[model samples]
Target chain A: MLAVLVGSGAMAQEIPAEPAIETAPEPEPIPEPPPVLHPPRNIVAQDVPHDNGGVLNIQWEPPIEGVPVRYVLEMAGEDGFFQEVTRTALTQYTVMQLENFVPYRFRVAAVYEKGQSMSPETEPVMARDHWLKLGEMPVLIAIFVFGSLLLFFIQAARRGVELFVRRISGLTAVEDAIGRATEMGKPVLYVPGTSTIEDVATLASLNILGEVARRTVHYDVKIICPNKDPIVYTIAREIVKETYASEGRPDAFDPDSVFFMVPDQFAFAAGVDGIMVREQPATIFLMGMFWAESLIMAETGASTGAIQIAGTDSVAQLPFFITACDYTLIGEELYAASAYLGREPMLLGTLKAQDYGKLVFLIIMVVFTLISVFSGYDAASLVRVR
Target chain B: MKRRFPMTIMFLFAIWGGISVFVGKTKVHDFDNLLRNKLLLIVGAFAIILGLGSLIFHHTQKIKRKARFWQYSYVTLIALAVTTFIGLGGGVRGERSLPTIFGGTVIGAHDGLVYVFTSQAEKNLFMDEPSRYADPTKAVLELPREFETDFNRFEASQLREEIHLKHTALQLKGQPIPPMISPVSNQQVAYKKEFKISLQQLYEGILVPCGSTMFAMLAFYMCSAAYRAFRMRNLHAGVLLVAAFIVMLGQIPLATAFIPGLHELRQWILDVPNLASKRGIMIGVGLGASATSFKIILGIERAWLGGGE
Candidate 1:
């Protein structure tokens, strides 16, 4: 029985071959060949205008025959092999990074799924650099007119011609603020803005600082100037030292007075605020390029009961300075402050030129507005800068 | 002559700047970019040396003199030293090593199994879920990428082979079944190959929070400024107050639900009057900046030359 069971098991384990069933294979569908496409026509390649050289603008009309998936832009040097520059679906493409003043030829290839056809090669063209950007003619003309007026006024002032000047209350208050600080026996805190020398506002603030330094020396008042930029720190130190020498009191210029605070924005604001709260300065000068921290510093100064005078060319910061400070220099007033205080003929002449420039700009705005309203034309395009 | 020499160079560069703006030449732009980027950056880098010297000198003097708040100077100096050391020695996210001891055990049988950990936090993390981090069949711990360091890193196949060999050896011993982690050995060699707290971590953990706190203070300051400026004292103040009120009201959904026209009124106020005034200031500022640049280039504004007329 055991042998019978073993034999049956072996028989069960033995593989049985099933009868093979034959079947016909389904017919495969043949793929149709892609239609031929013609290359673009009237291909024009020229140097881009009013830009640095080594760039060419290529444009073409669509092909008359079948459309292509994309057009391949190929370029070659005078004798170099053709290389694919770029592929574009549009009719126009800007070829860049070519050698200036070197003639090059370009061709367009209409690329299809199966095949591609090349357009006739364009004439050899060289990218030329323009000496003057003609697209900036409007700006150049305006600069010329304004600059000529400045030169004329500067020349006139150099000849000792008396020019009428207006009085700015903010400039007049500088002396009083210094006197107030002197009487209080507290230091005058001067923040020459939390910006680098690259900003003109900081330069203007430094210019104003020189005059303020001179006055502080004359009045025997202590001045605490904190800086945020390393370069500005060096310049401010020199200005203060020079101002002391010019005022015949070199000993009073403390080397540590014009110190550098942290260069961070909010950190500088917090440091200045801490100084305001601790030192309790009698007067604070917030001048230079300021962003969101303007209000924080100004309000802190206000809380300290310090006489604050803020000036900034940053239009967004003007409202903050105006609200928190006792005296605020608005818009162009900050730039005019140095001249207003110095009373130098050349500086005053430049200030007058700036006013004239504004007048001319106003007239231009009026004329443009009239043209836009009457002629229904966008005259802004004429002066629009690229 | 000291000032005149610098002014002469400044004059040349200024003229070059003005001319370069209108010259569409690649060489000119290249030179201009070189001066603006490379030259300025090199000088700025050197200036950092001067800044560090000044900072160190200022703090040293304060500590020597026992000046006001002199205790704070020590803190500043210590912080500076620590930050510099960490910044230079250990790069922002550079690695550091530490010893690690692996410990775990299965508590109960079936799917309700728990992992016995040395620390309570780790125990709670893997409680009643041994399969969450470790595979019973695989006999390997699946550590998160952030937690897995070079010393602890093991290839899956290699670790499985090692664990399998150990498991088979234990099984052949004919002893009672051992714990999941005990089978791998109590003290597995692991040298922590990465720092858990790096300079970047310090910056994000400390400086970022401080900066955020400072920035958050702006809201209070803005409120104070607005409250003071919006007082009904003069015509301008009244106008500002009303405009601010309208804008504030328009920003809220409840006010708009009451009067939909308030939104349009707010839009007109912002788009027309506010934008017009902003543009006026912008134009004035632009002209003023241009004039200042011209003056500086012409040497009419000599204050920037370190205080010479």
Candidate 2:
């Protein structure tokens, strides 16, 4: 019997066994439950108003049940693929610098601890430019009033109406200074400030330079003007040349008189100081905007014992000018210098308009103070720009 | 015509500038940006070229005429040339060398011994017992006969320090080896780009210090000016002197401590009276600037255009 069992085992080993038969084709495996997800709702995208365009205000509501860890905002592409814009904890976001005229769709997803679910996509919204900015109405009205006053005064001057302008001592001294330079046989040094042409102070200084150049020509006195900006140098050179030509002494205008020294502030100051020490000009005119170098240049001019006249709209530099200069045109006086020097009626009219604007400002200040005291209203806020 | 053309352009641009300030429209901003960024940038570039030409012409004329301080022009021109050459040729960051050779790494340990997988060429030499390579710069196989027997952590560290010292000496000479695998530590040893001097260093070391010195000179100038300005020649001078004294005294801790409520008093002066005067000046300046801008825009102020009516 053992030999027979061995023979059967040998036979089983020799032959390939058939496939085993199953009892109930194996019990089917249990399926996992679908994950519970909470998504944000009521996603909205609106065009931001009073903008240059390309801005949208996106807002969303949180999920109904549980609070989300955060929100994921997405913008849809042309292929309907959602690209993540930002992940934020807040419900609202401002998307800026989008294509102005292009329509955009947005979706928000509530990111929970377990999983995230997306909200219904918002309707297509397009950013558009508004005709006028409503927030700037106060500024617009103020500009209009000031402009009207200016026009009115200009017309009045054109009609030969007399205008009174206070004498600026600095401007009155300009001719005398040039005459002194002529007497001393020394050049008159003029610094037209260390600023670009874009600066209004530089423009004012240029206007004043024109008048100064004309006076220099009349006196036959040499003038030396140093500039820090290349554009200002060009303009100043032209003004000097043209002033000499108009005075019928074009040959007297030396092209090298008005020159660009340097662009760097302290470097220009050092150069100007060197020029002052070496040349020893009889009179120095410091005009336009100055910074820390104001004291440097002014002190150097003082050391040379020159009669220095300074004019600037820079409030900080005013003290330095007053300290080191014999005559100073403070604040608005610098702007009125051209009119004062030339005695032009139209220019004087503009000066009158500026004075009127100041009067209006004074009245507004008084009214605002009264309203604040009596009615507890923030009158300042009414004119406050956003 | 030359004057009229520029005046007309200026007038149109000035009006546009005013509108651009108040308008939030895209078209207005685009045009404004175009003028400010693109157009102005182009004009500025041309202006710089003209400025350089002017500088050259001025200096050359001064040198030819042997004007006062003509020798200084040579210094300026030479400095400009040298700076330009250094910036363009040597590069701003300065020169650098190739990386150093990689030494071996400690692979594993045998019975009372640590084995290192050395270089490929060295290993090949051991396997085949070939002749030395022709290149001397390549790392040499220096496996001593007594290496296995006399090897210790101390000798390995000493060797590493010796190599590091050599590299440091090279670095001080501005010839730094970039990076290499350290033999003893079995890690990378990196050396930063070391040079004698860089453009940025030159700017910081020379230019910045010069600027600071000039700025520092202002304090002395201010003191001198203050002495002259604060003299009691008149009522205005006395008022200025008193105000300056109070402000200066208020700034010092010892003075503030001695005088009670000195800080508050100073604050009141600054916040109320000083601020009121400053604001008044600012308002006047603003109105004047607006009026000037209006005159320029309306072509009423044409003196800026070369003494025109």
Candidate 3:
């Protein structure tokens, strides 16, 4: 048989018997499945505060021992079908951009290479819309206190209680400046700052501008208000027109005097500078929120030998104005100018209220400093506004 | 009616604005935004019209009376007209919708130059495939990196998504890369093409430089003003001069090295006196401004009503 097999193999190479394939050794015992993943504990889902809803803050405590697990956050809406929202190795997540008033149930699953272990589903947390934010408590308190004081003083003033506001030299010089303009037969350049009406400083300046306009109406000094904001230009035209009309010199109110120059800050400055160099108004009121242009305008007016009165709540620009302008209203003086100059009882009342508030604040500040210094009580920390 | 109507509206809106601050958990979810935003848009439209009217009237009067530097008004008016017309004619982005109904699904242009919108190749539409790399704020598009972008997450998410439809798979034999959305769908689609002029290009190229140039004139004005301001004549001026000089010197490391404790002095001035004064002013301004708001609301301040008209 061996000879036949050898002869067959020799005759045809394909005649060789197929070698018996060795039976595969029994596969090694299948490795024990990885230990069951430990689910996270203390899963809490809460609505985010001070938001317009649609946000949930989910937090969990990770199990100490896990099979190299990653946490998978799953959410189910009204559809009740849990969908994997995200995966993370974090203990907390702020889910954002959800629909308001939607009930969302969240579950966290510890997912390992072998299997997953899920925590019990959290109670459906409905995101409720909240209006007031707790962060603004200090602002609210300050406003309430300040507003009540103002109203109280105004009421007192209305009932013939005389309120005294300190004299501001800048405002007292208004008459002199306008008088000088009337004597020089030159225009009175009243700039209501480069800012719009949204700025309180601009509003304060506008109030002062109205008074200055009224004062100049009988004096016959042409008042030119170069406006940088169109709305302000329109409003200024009205104020000047009304002031002239009320003073029985309606024809003197030239609409073009309150024209708007370019809105660009520097361009407006340049335009006003050109006007200053050309017309050389005897008096200039550079008031309101001015930036770099404050110096340029004031210096140009000063170079023209005009009596320049600059005022602004912007402390950065105050130094420049004080250096260039003949009279500068620093900080609170700018706000106090309307009452000081116009002598309106309503405004004077507000000013007095502000002074009282300041006095109270100053006393508290000194007391707090003393406490913080000597007693180490940190009273400053308690009343810190922002 | 003119005064009362506005005052009523202002009072109501002011009250609304003030009260809206602390009502987040109420049933009025987004009521503040909806009402305020809508009203603002309407008023803004009217304000634009009024602004245009005032601008035209002012310029026309200037030209009629031949006011000083009246010739420059013509430049402004003409520029305004040209830019407004250009913006209107070409649209802000030069995007114009022309509807064309073509039968069949995604019949691309010759050489597969355009992609029909039948296959959701539109901007802002969700993609079937996920992105390669994801950031909270980065746009998902694989656009050319040369384009400048904003750091706004919402805007980035609203951009066109990258679709990797190979030209070979689409049987595009030979084509340039001007990916376009065709007008096969009912909704409007943008068909982009290379080398097209746009109004945005004009705005970015011309108007931006003009504005920048106008702003650039401030440096010269500042230098001139500073020269006039820094001169010493009085004690106050001397104090200011010394303070400014010290502050300026303290900023320079070489000067600080020579004058030991100069930087510390400057820091003390800035931290103690300067900050104290600033805080005092800020508190005053805050109270004053809030009082003004209350005054306006209560109708005690009528200066905005035109000299007590």
Candidate 4:
């Protein structure tokens, strides 16, 4: 059976004895090649003035064939050194950071990723550090307008300008709270919010603390001041000490009364609560940077039946203080509290300037809003030098 | 003369400082580091030490007097002594040897305490065959290597044997283990594991809430104080009370739920009138700050350095 199988396999191999030849048909020649892209013509380079230096604007037109092509902008110094600035699919580019007052030759080339066609160089253009003559106009106008208004207000105040500031209820309550404490023969608790001395709010609190100390001294009422920051603690101590000294009641100044509680926020709050509960001061003064503790401190003080007056610049905590404190200074009023109490001329002048600036800002805002509403946001109309 | 001389010097320095910063003449980066890092950091570190000393002294005085809860003083003292000893030991065995030892001990003790309480609690609560509880061997094994290092193996093995014995005895008695028992033990193990994981998370999360918990909790105490302290008993209080009420009710969801109109009113209060008032105050503050900054720059505000007193 194996021999028969072998014989059959050999016969199968010998069955296709005739040799075969095969051939492939040639492909048709490619169609005519596409036209080449040519370089742009009429290249122009202009110096952009009023800049530090080395800036130029180059523009050109595409060849008449109008085949879509990208433009290459290049610049070379007088020393025949060159660098490609940009390869834009547009006809223009602003070349910058060129050497000032130095001559430069620029050329434009039409380019595709595959190839580039160069244009003849434009006549050498010199970039100059041109100081724009009219550049100072806007600043000058601004200075003049502001300076005149400042001078005008100064003179008006000199002529006894009747500036009417709205009454802040928080400020009005300070005296009442202090008076209540004095009436009760209980100590007035003053806490310059949990911020360092460098914080404006802390300084403002210090100023108000001075005023409170003055009043407390006059009333022969005890005052307790607690601080969260060591630096603020020192400042508060100094302010209170100086105020007492100034009042000629240096003996009344109690160092123990003004103590540094834990610098930690909640720990400070807890300590303050302990103080409020233990001391049961008739009135509590809070001013400075406060957060969630505003409500905690205020609520605790409220529970103690201690009149609480709080001031802070933390917008998020203001609502909490407002709810929990008898009187709460919101936002910038904490800043104004110091000026209102101290009546420092520099502070007062700055306050007046701020008011003036705000008035100007309001007017500008109104005008801008009206113009935007009417003009439908035309780019040309909104453009201004300043 | 003492005050005036300092004031004069401060005023000049403040002005100089302000001009330098505003004119961009002073390198802001260098100045910021000097003020924030060098000055503030040194002062803050010393202040922290003072705070620690005060805490220790106050507690020590309480202990000496044998005041209420004075026994807690021993706990604090032991902790302090142990921490100092370990810290000063300088990791003679290895850098992390002491920490690993202490940390492991704490973790093991915590787990032991949980196990004891939970097991006893289950037993007292009439939990049948509580030992048949879901085995937490895998979870226990999964505990951090550091924790396992100080784990009380004897205690763990004893507890396991006790549980196994109880379980086998209950099974032999043909009594089914109570659902609550097994779940509670499983939960205890899960809780222990979760605690460790959460501690890891606390150290890893964007904020370490542990450090800030004391500060954040003050909000609660403050709220209590405010309610008791703030009352519209007088004229000034009346105005403050009204504003406070508006602001408070306006902030919560209750106001919107009760009176839809109040939401708009609140918005107006915040966006318009409130913003206007805030801006007005801010403008004043800005000017004040400018003047102060000017003074500081000119060296008039030397209070920052605790000088010029």
Judging by DockQ against the true structure, name the best candidate.
2
Candidate 2 at B41: error in angstroms? 1.6
Error of 2 at A313 (Å): 1.5
What local lDDT score does residue A152 receive in model 1, on the 0 to 100 scale?
Answer: 89
DockQ of 2: 0.41
Looking at model 1, residue A126 earns an lDDT score of 89
Pairs clashing in candidate 1? none
lDDT of 1 by residue, A1-386 (tens): 99999999999885888899888888898887666668899999999887767889999988898888999999999786899999999999988888899999999999887789899999999898877787878889888998898898889899999888777787789999999999999999999998898898898899899888878998899898888888888889899988888777888888878887778788788878988987899999998899888998999999999999999988788888988999998878888888888889988898888888888989999999999999999999899876
lDDT of 3 by residue, A21-125 (tens): 999899899998768678888999999887556788999998767654588999999999999989998888989888788899999998878788899999999
lDDT tens readout by residue for model 1, B1-309: 888898899889888888899999878988999988899888888877777777777778878988777777788788788777777665554233322233333222223222233233333434435346353322234322222222223332344445566557657988544454232332331211111234664576567677678888889988899898999999989999999999999999999889969999999999999999888887778777877888888888877665545
Superposed by TM-score, candidate 2 places the C-alpha of residue A121 at a distance from the truth, in angstroms, of: 7.0
Ranking by lDDT: 2, 1, 3, 4
lDDT of each: 0.79, 0.79, 0.73, 0.63
TM-score of chain B of 1: 0.69
Model 2: pairs clashing at backbone N, Cα or C within 3 Å: none
User: Model 4, stretches more than 4 Å misplaced?
Assistant: A1-24, A28-165, A343-351, A376-386, B4-13, B20-36, B43-288, B291-309
Q: Write the per-residue lDDT of candidate 3 for residues B1-309, one digit (tens) a residue.
A: 867887898899888777777556555535677766776566656755666676777778889999778897798799888767667665654343322233212212212122232222221222222231122212212333322232222121123221233323233756454343211221222332122233565666665665577557657757776676678878877887788788889999999999999999999888988899899988888777777777778888776666755
Q: Tell how far residue A209 is off in model 3, in angstroms.
A: 2.4
* Backbone collisions counted per model: 0, 0, 11, 43
In model 3, what lDDT does residue B85 have?
A: 69
Tens-place lDDT digits, model 4, residues A1-386: 99999998988785755677666768899997866767788898987655434668888888766555578788888778778888788888888767666789998878765677889998888766543323335444544455455456545655765655567798888888889988999999998888776687777677678788888988989988877887677667777877787788889877556666656676677778877887799999988888767777877788899888898877678767877778888766776676555454434443565467557656866787777789777433342542
Regions of model 2 farther than 4 Å from truth:
A1-45, A57-124, B84-205, B252-260
**What global local distance difference test value does model 2 have?**
0.79
